[model samples]
Target chain A: MMDGSMALPFWLDALIALLLLGGALVALLGSIGLARMPDFYMRLHGPTKASTLGVGATLLGSMIWFGVGHEGLSVQEILITVFLFATAPVSAHMMARAALHRRVACRERTHGEPWDEMDRLPGYAESSSSSDSQR
Target chain B: MTATVLPIALALFSLSLLLNLYRLLRGPDIIDRILGLDTLNVNAIAVIVLGGIYMDSSLIFEAALLIALMGFVGTVAMTKYLVRGDVIE
Candidate 1:
């Protein structure tokens, strides 16, 4: 079909490109963390913190596209950015705690006993102090 | 027109989503799956924004908002379950 619609300005297009590129890079990093990080506790830090930022960047890019090209403010993307920011951390915290609990349990089974926090705390402190002295 | 630009952005976003999917599938631990799932939700929201751009309709924005809401609540619920092993408690 023949076209009469106004062309998007160069700046607007550049903004969109920047958004996608940034978003993709964020995702790539999260995936890398998922692959490279060792153990559950260590791995938990990567995607929840870093990738949330990445998605926000990408969403902001999309918001620019919609706002400049289509109508007024892209409120939906704004809302999404807000929601993602709020929940990503909460979820990661829960999962990490669960993983930690599971790890603690797993260790107990292997050792044929559970560690009491009260009993272990002083021993842990003394050993830590001794190790620090040796260092 | 924005139409031409929309597709390229959508395609790139889709590729990101697929990459997240691959991570989800290959995750060696439960935390990886949770991370992958979070990425997927973020990508879904991105797609909704892209949809609005592609169609030049503000209506798609509502869908994006809903996705954002659902994704957050769902992630929170899943995380709670993982920790407490109970939805209410």
Candidate 2:
């Protein structure tokens, strides 16, 4: 039996609605950034950061909705939030390195412009132009 | 119980999925595309969770768990390959 007051149902619904709204807002911001960012590395910041949070909030909202609806406190919803925190960065790192291996170049448009410049590391060819643009 | 909320959440999640699709298509670089795929995976998890909510079934939670566990492994291995050219040292 749900221990909380009967009024809790209304509260829970309100909470879920707020969470969904927040998640949608975050998702929207990520999409905007995806379109607005100028370079690959800059673009990486959008979905990895914002979309992850967006999905997390949305899933968490769903989890709470169902858990409370069923009058159970199971935390199964946390699985995605935990997974996102773990996987998103690793994937981003991999993609960034792969792009580098392909000699993917960056645009010097963002605040942290150091990555755009070719490093003097051994065994890597320095390209004067962004790789994707060249293609 | 609020009957309409489930359908609304489903619709919103699908919209998010579409946004991720746009990234996959319009990415200027390969890594941007990979990032988009990662976003897609997370969005997929959200959809599964929301589906569980709508159906009042816990089975979807198990699938969500598997995705959570394996997705991390897949991403780590892929990232390792991208960085060192091999998943294992």
Candidate 3:
């Protein structure tokens, strides 16, 4: 089955290639940011946004490739894309909150974090450890 | 062109995965590790989808979607547990 974009037009194939390559590069940048960033909040920006966008672009490319070249409109790719778009920020927000609750260290320039955050949490105690939550 | 580009793209994503693994292993703190794991999940999904495209099979889309949902759920669950001592009340 020659359903790949090659069976389509050269221009269409180029577009697919661009999309996949851009997505991959963006994802690589995000992971580089993740591995190299100095602060937790700084690190938060990497995977949550850039990585999500990277994956989104790739999925979009695949969606078009499959939709046109292969089967007719594979909804699963779109579902994954939208679901990831919706969830990335939510998870990022929750992770930030968790980091704050656990009082994870921030970079020196980070501002607005309350030093007296011990009482900020409703159930701070009765837990295992902030460094690593109990599994 | 896609013949050449596909493998290149796959390699880039795998390198990204390696960076994420480095972060997960060498993260200074727990949140960083969690972030690493989350990024790993996202990249892994892309790799799976890319692999599907390479194989010219749409069947793996199901696996990609499943990973997407599970990744979100796992991230949320871990964050929730960290935010509060309990996952469910």
Per-model DockQ against the true two-chain complex: 0.35, 0.37, 0.62
Superposed on the true interface residues, model 3 gives a C-alpha RMSD in angstroms of 2.7
Q: Which stretches of candidate 3 lie over 4 Å from their true place?
A: A1-4, A111-135
What residue runs in model 2 are displaced by over 4 Å at the alpha carbon? A1-8, A69-71, A97-103, A108-113, A116-135
Tens digits of per-residue lDDT for model 2 on B1-89? 33455567667768777877888898876566666666777777877876766676666787877776776676667666665556775
Q: Which ten residues in a row have the lowest lDDT in candidate 2 chain B?
A: B1-10
Docking outcome class, model 2 = acceptable
Candidate 1 per-residue lDDT, tens place, A22-48, comes to: 675676576567556655555566667
lDDT of each: 0.65, 0.68, 0.84
C-alpha lDDT of residue A60 in model 3: 85
* DockQ agreement of candidate 2 with the native complex: 0.37
TM-score of model 1 vs. true structure: 0.71
Candidates arranged by lDDT, highest first: 3, 2, 1
Candidate 1 residue spans exceeding 4 A from truth: A1-7, A104-135, B1-8
lDDT of 2 by residue, A42-115 (tens): 77788778878887788777667666647474566665566677767777766776766665667755465444
> Which pairs of residues have clashing backbones in candidate 3?
none
Q: Note the residue pairs that clash in candidate 1.
A: none
